[model samples]
Target chain A: MIEILLLVHLILAILVLSIRSLFTAVILMAIFSLFSAVLFFVLHAPDVALTEAAVGAGVSTFLYIWIVKRTQKEVK
Target chain B: MTTTLAFDLIGYLFVASSVVSLYRVLWGPTIPDRLLGLNVASAQILAILVLYAAKEKLHVYLDVALVYDIFGFVGILALTKFLEKRHRKGE
Candidate 1:
């Protein structure tokens, strides 16, 4: 079960790098943080999981989305 | 014995379904479609956590899942707000 989640993380990281849009990449990164938090929980580190969920998924995602919005090109 | 096996199976199923949602996130043509996929994936993740916590009889995992739920909600709220603001600016 844990192995499968790790595999998903691997695949998502590769997809994040390969995506063309900055917005999609940011969203993918958010998903990455989520799965990693789960991974930490399964590994018997509940405290780490909590921190990862709060900072990685919550704070960082908001910050990345803000960055993307500030730098994107307007569509015609 | 049977109950444990059933819980294990359901957990795997949820994970698989989340992977399927990832396909949409990877190939979605529009921003909203990707966001939809992301939302589905996060919900599925929450389900998995709850299922495992029940299976292992751990209360701490439940708290982790709760924090995860709160963070996911706030993150999505912020994301959509940013998107909405961008959309308005585009007009």
Candidate 2:
């Protein structure tokens, strides 16, 4: 049901936010964003869902990965 | 009864994650970590808006979510560019 899906999404979001590795964080965040978009759709907000899908899954993740690649060597 | 319980459960889950995201924003080690936490929080805000829209049977919240989406993107891009500039200047 919706509750289960939401729980999974929350867990993923927590994993994304708490993980140490930048690369893994980006991937987990991408997944988290995708699920958030789906949650929006389930909540009957197609416009918000579309924006979330494009921005979260598409642009934000790409930006995060690009920055990670650019700054990977600097990490301690 | 089941449906109400389901909605309540999901709502609580969303709230819990939002709280955790706030914690990340508070204690994030680096600038990017802070930015990422902020971005995720905004995304969660959008999700909450969408949920409210459904619960209240109103479309106006969707508009707010759309605007928030644009603002979050621009803010993240600006922060990233600013960070990059600072890093370069430090080099």
Candidate 3:
């Protein structure tokens, strides 16, 4: 089960990097964090999961969106 | 035995959903579509956490999921507010 999860995580990461849209990529980055958190949990590292969930999925996504909002080009 | 099978079944389903959502994240023509994809991705992640905790019978994993819930909420809220501010600022 855990190995399958790891495989999924690797696929997601590669997809995120190869994608064109920055926003979509950023969101994948968020999901990537959750994958790591689950991986940590499966490995019996609750403390690492706690931080990954709190910071990776939480703070970083907001910051990425903020930067995107600030720097996004106007459509028209 | 049956319960574990059920849990794995649900987990696989969620993994598929996340994979499907990746398309939107990869080539969403508009910003809103991509945002929605991201939102769905996060929810599916929470579901995965719940399923795992239930199957493993771990109290601490549940706690981690709760913290994930709170942080994910805050992240989305902040992003929405930022976008709204940008909209109102006439950018």
Candidate 4:
């Protein structure tokens, strides 16, 4: 299970980097955080899980979306 | 021991399904579809947390799961609101 979760994390990171849309990348990042939090919990670190759940999944996602919302797309 | 094994099996099932659901997020034709996939993924994570808490006899994880649900809700809400405003702005 741990290995599977780690594999998923790697896939998400690559997808975030390769995806065309910034919005999609932000959403993928939130998912990445979600799994990492779960991984922390599974590894017996509930404190880190709590922090990651709040800061990574919640605050960072909102902040990223906010930044993405305000920025203009670069011209090709 | 069987119960632990059962919980492990269920966790694997949830993980597999969530992974399959990522297909929607990756190939989604629209923003809302990706958001829906994200919602599904978070819910599955919450379930896995509860399963672990039960399996290992750790009550504290219950609180983590609760807070995670709340955070997922708020994150999705904020994303939708941002998308709505962007839609109104025409890009």
Clashing pairs in 2: none
Give model 1's TM-score versus the native structure: 0.91
Q: Which number leads on TM-score?
A: 4
Please give, for every candidate in the order listed, the TM-score of chain B alone compared with the true chain B. 0.94, 0.84, 0.88, 0.94
Instruction: List the lowest-lDDT window of 10 residues for candidate 3 chain B.
Output: B22-31
Query: Which of the predicted structures, 2 or 4, would earn the higher TM-score when compared with the native?
Result: 4
**Native contacts present in candidate 2, fraction:** 0.00
- How would you encode candidate 1's per-residue C-alpha lDDT over A18-69 as one tens digit per residue? 7777777888899899899989977889889989999988999999888777
Q: Which stretches of candidate 1 lie above 4 Å from their native place?
A: A72-76
Writing each residue's lDDT as its tens digit, candidate 3 over B4-86 gives 89988998888778768767865778767777877887788778888888888988888888999999888777766766786
Q: Give lDDT tens digits, candidate 4, residues A1-76.
A: 8999999999999988888778888899999999999999989999899999999888999999888878954323
Off by over 4 Å in 2: A1-76, B1-5
Residue-level lDDT of model 4, residues B2-82, one tens digit each, is 887899899999989888888888889998999999998888888899988888787899889988998888888888998
Q: What is the DockQ of candidate 2?
A: 0.05
Give lDDT: candidate 1, residue A73: 36
Q: What TM-score against the true fold does each predicted structure earn?
A: 0.91, 0.51, 0.78, 0.95
- Go through the candidates in order and give the C-alpha RMSD of each one to the true structure: 2.4, 10.8, 3.4, 1.4
Two-way DockQ contest, 2 vs 4, winner? 4
Q: How far is candidate 2 from the true structure (C-alpha RMSD, Å)?
A: 10.8
lDDT of 3 by residue, A1-46 (tens): 5776788688888977777656566777877887788789778887
Model 1's number of clashes is 0
lDDT of 2 by residue, A1-76 (tens): 3675587677777776677767556655755675576577667677787787677765787677678766863335
Question: For model 4, what is the C-alpha lDDT against the true structure?
Answer: 0.88
Please give the range of 10 consecutive residues that has the lowest summed lDDT in model 4 chain B. Answer: B18-27
TM-score of chain B of 2: 0.84
